[model samples]
Target: MKSIVPCLWFSDDNCEAAVNYYVSIFPNSSIESMSYYPDEALDEHFIGKTNKVITAEFILNGQRLMALDGGPVFRFHEAVSFTIECEDQAEIDYYWEKLSHVPAAEQCGWVKDQFGLSWQIVPYNMGSLIQSDAQIQAMMAMKKIIITELENA
Candidate 1:
């Protein structure tokens, strides 16, 4: 059992779809388990959402996460985001291409996926690179980070 895990609340009824999408994107990932709202509870509270996913436990890139179909009481925000540390430009490009769905939200290597989850596709050495004077300016100029440009900067 994981000591701590991130729980994502989904307003939509597509929690399974979202889990599958994330499992497909990351390596060593799989759906660990799933549970649905009881019929009595569903009838009493969920209304039309019968048999809907109440919670789903999954692993993404070896990290355990839980997804909850919690209705529209809450929403995802940029304040909470997952960072994908890429080994090189290829990995960065791959994650960016697969995860980025909202163009307007793309900025400084950060992107918002179709499910409104924000992700940062960054090179593993981004910390050191950002420490350089010119690299900071170069990063600010583009949405997706270019490793070569950072190296040059």
Candidate 2:
């Protein structure tokens, strides 16, 4: 079977730092392999990044992911995001605390990290919890998912 590996594009030279941050946050996560840009590259875009990480493959909670320093021409946006399904409110808060960096972009359990990657920190039973309009409203008002509030709503 052809396996699909998700890739994250970090702006300019921050890919390695972002990969390290992610690995530190999750248990059982580590860098699988890394490759650097050619030291003698002719492209102006990669001039100072010769010693920087070109590609870094890593695992997050057993899920494999790849990241690269693809220059400032491209960036991570809300169009693509990683969703973390939390077992409880504590799990939700933990991931939220670790990933949330852009306060202005936060809404409805979704937040943008320092790397500008969007992440949805939500409850595992989100589908069941948002069945009612009240519950949905409660969730929509939250930056991080609150399980008990959703249940009470």
TM-score of every candidate: 0.94, 0.94
Q: Count clashing residue pairs per candidate.
A: 0, 0
RMSD of 2: 1.4
Model 1 error, position 75 (Å): 0.2
Q: Tens digit of lDDT per residue, candidate 2, span 19-102?
A: 999999999899999999987567776668778899999999999999988888898889998999998888998999999999
RMSD (CA, Å), each prediction? 1.6, 1.4
lDDT of 2 at 122: 89
True-vs-predicted CA distance for residue 104, candidate 1, Å? 0.5
Question: How well does model 2 score by local distance difference test?
Answer: 0.91
- Model 2 is weakest, by summed lDDT over 10 consecutive residues, at 38-47
lDDT of 1 by residue, 1-153 (tens): 538899999987778789989999899999999998777653568676767788999999999999999988898999999999999999999999999999999999999999989999999989988887799999999899999998899
- Judged by lDDT, which candidate is best? 1
What's model 1's lDDT at 18? 91
Model 1 TM-score (2 dp): 0.94
